[model samples]
Target: MKKKRKSLFWKFLDGVEKVGNRMPHPVTIFAILCVIVAVVSHITALTGTTVTYQGVDPKTFKAGEVTVKAVSLLNPEGIRYIFTSAVTNFTSFAPLGTVLVAMLGVGVAEETGLISTSLRKLVLSTPKTLITIVVVFAGVMSNIASDAGYVVLVPLGAIIFASVGRHPIAGLAAAFAGVSGGFSANLMIGTIDPLLAGISTEAAHLFRSDVSVTATSNLYFMIVSTFVITALGAFVTEKIVEPRLGEYKGSHTEIVEDITSDEKRGLKYALIAMILFIIGMVLLTAPANAILRDPKTGDILGHSPFMNSIVLIIALFFLVPGVAYGIGAETIKSDKDIVNGMSKAMSTMGSYLVLAFVASQFVAYFSYTKLGTIIAVKGADALEAAGLKGITLILMFVLLTAFINLFMGSASAKWAIMAPIFVPMFMQAGFAPEFTQVAYRIGDSTTNIISPLMNYFAVIVAFASKYDEDSGIGTLISTMVPYSIIFLIGWSILLIIWYFAGWPIGPGAQIFL
Candidate 1:
C-alpha cells in the first residue's frame, strides 16, 4: 500500500505550529528587536538614507521637501538612553496603565464571584439556540469596557460551552475571535475609537490643517461589522471550529458552582447598581447643558471630559457594581477585602509587567530612531508609484496594513507611524482619510488574534492551558487562523460592496476626499 499524505492545509498548519513553537518568548522577541532596531539605525545613518516629503512638516509651518534621516541609536548618547529612560519608558507605556486600572475593577468582580455568577445567570437565561450568538455578541461589545473583555469573557466563553457539552476550546476560540479579531468593531464608541481617531487626526493634519477626524469616524461601519463578526463567529464556532475539535475530553471544573442564594442576591445587587449607573450617565450626557458634554460646543464626542475620562469611567462602572455585589454576597466584609481583591489582580500581571517593560523599550527605541517614519514614507512613495486606483488601491492598502500588523500589534502606535505618510498619499490619490483609517482598522483587528506582539496574547494562552495543559502558541494560532482568514475576506467583501454603493463609512465621512 502507498503511504498516505496529510492535506496541504494540515501540513501548513503543522508548519506554522512548529515555527511558532520554535520562536522565543515575546519578551525575548522584543529584546532581539531592540538590538535589531539599534543596528538598523546605525546602518541607515552610515548609508546616508533619507526621505524628502512634499507635505507640510508639522515641526515647521512650511510645505516643502523636508528631508527625514534615520538617527543612529548605537552612539554613546544612545547607550545612555537605554539605561536612563528604561523606567520612564515602562511607566509611560500606553497599555500598561490602562490595563492595570481596568483590571483593578475587574479583579474585584472576579474575586468577589460577581463575574462568575453574572455570566452563569446570563448563559442559563439565554435561549439555547442563541448561546453561541450571545457569547460572540457579548465578546464584541466587551471592547467598550476595554481589556476587561479579555480577562472575563474569554474564559467565561469556554465555561459556557463546556457546560453545554460542547468543546471548551471552541468556545474560547469564538470569544477570542470576537474580542481580538473583531477588536475595532463595536456597537458603541470605545476607548480605541478616540485613541485611533486622535492619531488619524494628527496624521491628517500633515495633508491639510483644516481637516479633522472625529472619534466616531468609523462608527457606522463598526456597528455593521459588529453584526458581521457575530454571525461569522457563530458560524465558525458551530461549523468549522467546533466540528474540528470533535468533543470535549477535559474536566468541567471551570464551570461555575451551583448558583447559591447569596450569589443570586449579589447579582441582583450588581444589576441594580449597573442600572442606576447607566441612568446617571444618561442624565449626564443626554440633555442640553449636560455636565459631561463639551462646555464650548456642548458635544459629548469631541473635546469633552466624558471622552477624556472614559477609562476612569469604565473603571468606576465595573467597580461600583462589583462592590455592590461583593457587599451583598458578603465576599467583601471589610475595606481590607477590597484592597486584597485589587492586590490579587495586580499579582496576576507579574509576567505581563516583564513583557511590557521590554516591549516599551522596543517601542521607544523604534520611535526615537525615526526608522518607522522613514519606512512609512518610503513605502507610501512606492505604493503611489504603482498607479493603483479605486478598489485596487483600497484593497492594497488593507493588505499592506494587515502585513504590517503582524509585526506591530498596537493599533494606535502603528497608525501614528503610518498615518503621516499614507494619509497624505491617500489624499493626493483622491481617497478620504477616514476611508484609509477604516481599511487600516480592518487589517489591524483581523491580525490581532495571530500576532504574538499583541499585549494580551499571553493571557489568551494562559486561558487555553486551563482546558488543555499542552496547549501552546501554535495551538491558539492554528485554531484562530480560520477566523482571521474569514474575517479578512468577509470584511473586505463588505468594504467593496460599500465602496461600489458609495456609502459613507460614518457620519459625514466619505470614501473620497
Candidate 2:
C-alpha cells in the first residue's frame, strides 16, 4: 500500500521546522539586526527622511509637535557609540537587573527543592476525577520555577494518567499546554512579570519618559487568565486530544509516588513563612500611615514605596519561604546551599546575558538614530489612516505577535525587538504600554505550544516519545494545537471584554491611556 500524502497543515509545520532550523541563534539575529539598523540609519539620514508628529506626553501631558530626523549611526559619532556605549547599554537594559535579582530568590527556592516539591505535592494529591485540571493548573503555577514544569509535571502527568487508565500522551499534552501555552498567566507575579515589564518600561521611554511598566502591571488579567487557561487545557485534553489519542495500548504504566515526609514538612514551613510575609506586608501597606504606602496620597499601588520596591519585594517573598522550606527539609545546612542555588540560577542565564548584550546595543542604536520613534509615528499614522482602532487594532497586533512567535521563540528577546515599535505605536493610538504588553503576551503565550521554535518544544517531543515510541514533533504539535487555538480565542475575547468594560488590567494599570 502507498503511504498517505501529508496534509497541508503537516506540510506547513514541516516547512516551519526547516526554516526555523536554518535561522541562527537569537544572539546572532540581534547582532545582525543591530547592523541592519545602523545601515538603515545611514540611508535614511542621508535621504533626509524625517517624520513630523506631536502628541501629549502621557506622563506630563505636555503637547508638542516636533520634526524627527533620522541620525546616521554609520558616522564617526555613531561608531563611537557602537564602542563606548556597550557597557552602559548592557548595564542599563531594564530586564537585566530585574530578572537577575528575582532569580536569586527563585533560585534559592528551586535549589532548596521548594518549587519542585510543591508542584509534585499539588499534582499527586489532586483527585483523580480532577487530575487533568490539577495537572494543568500545577503546570501554570510551575512558571515560578522556570522550566521545572516541563521536566517534572509533564512526565509525571504521563505517569499519573497511565496509572489512572487514561491516555498518557493526552495527559502530557494537558501539562504542556498549561506550562507553555499559559506561560504568561499566573495567579501571582513570576520572573516573567519583571522581565517583560522592564522591557515595556524601556520602550515606553520613547513616548512618555516617566511612564513605567511595573511587574504588577498585568496582575489582575493574568490572575483571571490562570483559570481561563486551566479550564481550556482541561477541556481540550478531555474532549479533543484524549479522544483523538484513543486508548493507551503501549503498556508502559508508572505510579506517581507522593512527596516525602521531609517535603511535606518543608511545604508546611514554607506556607507558614509565606503567611508571615503577607502579614508583614499588610502591616506595612494596609494602614493609611504605613511605610509602604504613599506618604502624600496613601496609595499603595501607584507611585508608592511598595510599588517602587516591587522587585525587591518579589525577591524577598521567594527568599523567605525558600529558606524556610530549606530549613524544614534539611536542604540548607548552611548559607552555602542558598548561595549555590542563586549561583545555579545565574549560571543558567548565561545565554540570556549574551543575548541581552547584543539586544541592548541594538536598542541603544535604534534610540540614538531616532529610528524607533520614526517607525512608531509612521506606523501609528498608517494605522489611523487605515481606520483601525480599539479592539480591531489590538486583535491585529495579537495576530501579528502570534505569527512572529512562530519564528522567534524567546519571549524577552522578541519583546525587546517588538516593544519599541509596537508599544509606542499603540500608545499613539490611545493605549497604555501595559495594555500593549498584555496583548503581546496573549499572542506570545497562546502560540507557544504550537511553535516549533519554542526552546522547550524538542524536550516536550522527547517526553511524548517515551509514552509512544512513534510520537514525534507532529504528534506533539498536533496534540497541542487545540489548546493553542482555544487559548488564543478565549484570551483575546477576555481582553476585548476588558477593553469595552473599562476594566483595570492591574492595580494601577488600565487598558487605555
Measured by TM-score, the strongest candidate is 1
Which pairs clash (backbone N, Cα, C closer than 3 Å) in model 2?
none
TM-score of 1: 0.84
Return the TM-score for each candidate structure: 0.84, 0.63
List per-candidate RMSD values in Å: 4.1, 8.2
Model 2 agreement with the true structure over 1-513: per-residue lDDT tens digits:
012115564455455434543556545766887888899999999999998765433333234455789998889998898888999988987656766787788789889988767656655666777989988998899887565566556766776677677898988888899888999999987766766777788778788898989989999999999999999899989877787667888968644567888988999999999999999999999987999888998876545788777767777888899999999999999999999999998886765677667777776777788775566456545544676777898998887778767756667756765676678878998999999999999999998898745655645665676677565555676677778889999999999989999899998999888
Model 1: CA > 4 A from native: 1-5, 54-67, 145-152, 155-159, 162-172, 189-217, 242-252, 256-258, 283-297, 408-434, 458-472, 508-513
Runs off by more than 4 Å, candidate 2: 1-5, 127-256, 387-513
What is candidate 1's lDDT per residue for 1-513, written digit by digit as tens? 011115566566667767865777656867988999999999998898998765433223233455778888888888888889999988998667767887888788888888778767766777878989988899999888667677667877887887667788888999989999999899999877866776677677777898888888899999999999999989988876776566778775446457899988888899999999999999999999999999998877644878766667777788889999999998999999888989998897886788778888887887788786676567667777888988888888888777777766667766766676678778888888899999989988998898766767766776787688666778789888989989999999999998899899999999888
Clashes of each: 0, 0
**Model 1: which residue pairs collide?**
none
